[model samples]
Target: MDAANLEFIIQMLEQDTDLKEKIKDQVTEFDKKTRTMAGLLNKIHSTPTAQLPPLLDSVQPILASCTDITAVIAQLVPANQFWRWKDMWCNSLRSAVFSATLIEYLRSGTLLTLPQVGGILGIHPEWADRFTLAAEDYLHGLISLVNELSRLAVNSVTLGNYEEPLRISAFVKDLFAGFAMLNLKNDLLRRRYDSLKYDIKKIEEVVYDVSLRKLAPTPAK
Candidate 1:
């Protein structure tokens, strides 16, 4: 990405305040639920082994009712097959892991500083050292999906035709005309992905800074 392109993309990202709010809302909702789950799990751990069975029995139904994973996934996937639901599922799992990690951080008050995301994400220190890699994976997946959808759209315009540029041009124009509706959806989806990845970076930075400050040695008298 050239500097100009990068700058433009950054500006585009900043322009969508409402989308950022929605992303924040989504993260907040997930965080709240994860915290609740963490507290419950902590309580479960604190309970005696002998008493655990009955306690878990009572909690199982409630936990199951709290959120329907399948339903949520269904709601997230677009109807089009080219949109890559599999990548969404993969990223969702990663997000869940991050959420769980955050919940653990809150419950234990452990200093999960920077230089530690690699370990959290199961990446060795020698390999790579930031949450941005995870975000890159997400962005690449979404970009591939969008490119595939664009290709599919192009293919639909040229289907079963040869040596007829005029006919293809007319049909392609019509196809694009219909595809115009996707413009806003594409912008929104891209913005959401970018904002989310950016937010992940911010979270990592904040946690790291806080952890380091907390872990710093006391000053000499």
Candidate 2:
């Protein structure tokens, strides 16, 4: 082919502003849905501990709808720009995981693993690898979860629940240890990981205060 023809072919194959815009619109929907869920999460966190169960229950349908929106986004993304939009969807995915874990922590005070995060986003766990950004892997979202849990640890005590803080302390410490095993190359993730040290200390302090006061639940003899 002539040089002009070759250039035109490359442009046709590579230049995809129109599709990119459509994908952006879809991502905007995902963003909106996830943000709504985040708002509900804020409410859940702020609610009195006794009221948290009902708040969580009310948000369950909203979270499911957000996951549906995420699924729609995955289907709407054009194959040509799949990789191009990965970064755009990162926040939405992170929010979905946050919502999922918030529910789990409310119901059982359990740590939601990366695999379960996928289920929240309505995607299989394996897809987590595909969506990992070049600079920061998707697992960085776990740091966001840990961050919220730290705050929750403090709030749980104010709400008169010491057990949740203890559970959160154990979960955050375990998660931090797991992250330590990774040789993270991303500066953003590394910085986030470094900050986790302080968060872990904060939760530890909360647990320590409770134990020192003899307010913590007694262990079985």
Number of the predicted model whose TM-score against the real structure is largest: 2
- Any residue pairs clashing in model 2, and if so which? none
**lDDT per prediction?**
0.38, 0.74
Quality of model 1 by C-alpha lDDT: 0.38
TM-score of each model, paired residue for residue = 0.27, 0.82
Model 1 residue runs over 4 Å out of place are 1-16, 65-221
- Alpha-carbon RMSD of each model: 26.4, 3.3
Worst 10 residues of 1 by lDDT: 160-169
